[model samples]
Target: MKAFLDILKPNQLIYPNTVGYDWNQVDVNRPQGHPYYHWLQTNQGEGVVNIDNKSIILSKNDGILITPFTPHKYQSDQFWTTNFITICGYASIFFQKQLGEKKYFVLRESSCVDKDIYNLTNKLDSSCDDAQISLQTYKIFLDILHGVQQVSAEGYKSIPICWEIKNYIDDNYMEKISIKKIGRLFNISPQYIIKVFKQAFNISPYRYLTKKRISEAEKLLISNKDLLISEVANLVGFDGASHFIDVFKRVENCTPLEFRLIYYQGADFNHE
Candidate 1:
């Protein structure tokens, strides 16, 4: 049996200047094992991040706080663009102190404002030299630490219902999974599942299904670009492209065409 604790602590890295920091570029096929902490924000692309065998798709405008010693990787689907202020050195210490050896933490996307994240990243980008850059980097690093403390103060835990519903949705996303059916499976009332799941996960069961399905479709679109969007949709369990597009745009904040255009230009690809 593989205990959740069996995973190795992610080796931490603090690269003051990462490769291709300007224009938000990454080298595909380079698999890095070190963990990092960053004030990361992205737009106009989609990708999967693998953490402890759980693949999470980074949603548009999502801000992430990754913990140390967790093996993780990010791969872009198409032309990918992201602006992030990364603090690798001494950064992982804060998360390590808070989380210990735990490999994952799910930070709610609604916890921070978009403008604040962008402003911090912009400051890091405009630094003139290594000394100035490190100072700016350390400043934002402290901000991130402070933000984590605040989130910790809230004492937020992943609602068990959120994980249960998410697992149920992912396993049956290709089927005509319905809330009523889910309600029956859990031996709970349909309305109860709808209400609590929404409150816990901030997404209704149906919406969660659509989001996961489209995430599958995105992988297909990127790897097998020759396939039609409708085909990709069907492959992911959607009945048609129209339904997929409506939901995809809602979550991605852009149409499929626009996302493809931006992500494919400087796309990064990695799989685990």
Candidate 2:
């Protein structure tokens, strides 16, 4: 059985929908994602949480904060207990922006999570009015955010290489890019780029760029009906139409035209 604290709307900038403690968390799966931010921590045993394409393991004291609308699911690898809180409002948007490009964080510090915090908050909830509830909630939120920022700062040097490479790719994927160019910028070798990029993100830099290009191509095909396949390919950084078609087919299991025909025209996509 699981025990949780629920507070009705507190008429404040930051309020929690629910807070749970020491709960034997059942498997949770939400594909479209929860509407409010979910900040969770492991209290006992081990578990795994998958966010989008990446999976993270939660050991004792480890925590993860999932922002709104992030596809996620979690299950116990063995026995697991956790504490969690969900918060949202205008203030939540401010915090989310503060978190930067990523919508989720696999927090590795105790400061971001406290033990049996729901019990204390539950008592506060019973006695407090809307104003007090709001204040307390905002305080906890602020503390966690501040703690996460500190943890991130301390871990910055250890992380930047992978995130830097990914950020550069994200911003410049539409241009002519090469591993050598990226290596030169980072003062690292092309081989290191291939290996570290793969280790961190589980995909080669070249394939990552290709996938990014193809993703944009899909959007263009759906939205702009006038553009030819060749135009779409060039716009997304592919050199030639044939090459784009070949890569798209290999990756998406359909030609760009077929995808456009199916998704845009509202038909099933198996090319006749």
lDDT of 1 by residue, 71-185 (tens): 5677776665544543453223334543335554444452343444344345445645433344444444444544554454343244566567667887878877788888788
TM-score of 1: 0.43
Worst 10 residues of 1 by lDDT: 1-10
User: Which candidate leads the pack in lDDT?
Assistant: 2
CA shift at 77, candidate 1, in angstroms? 40
Model 2 score (lDDT): 0.72
Question: For candidate 2, lDDT tens digit of each residue in 129-222?
Answer: 6444555565566567655655555534465687788789878987989999999999999998888777665568897788778767866775
lDDT per model, in order?
Answer: 0.53, 0.72
Which ten-residue region of model 2 has the weakest summed lDDT? 263-272
What root-mean-square deviation over C-alphas does model 2 reach?
13.7
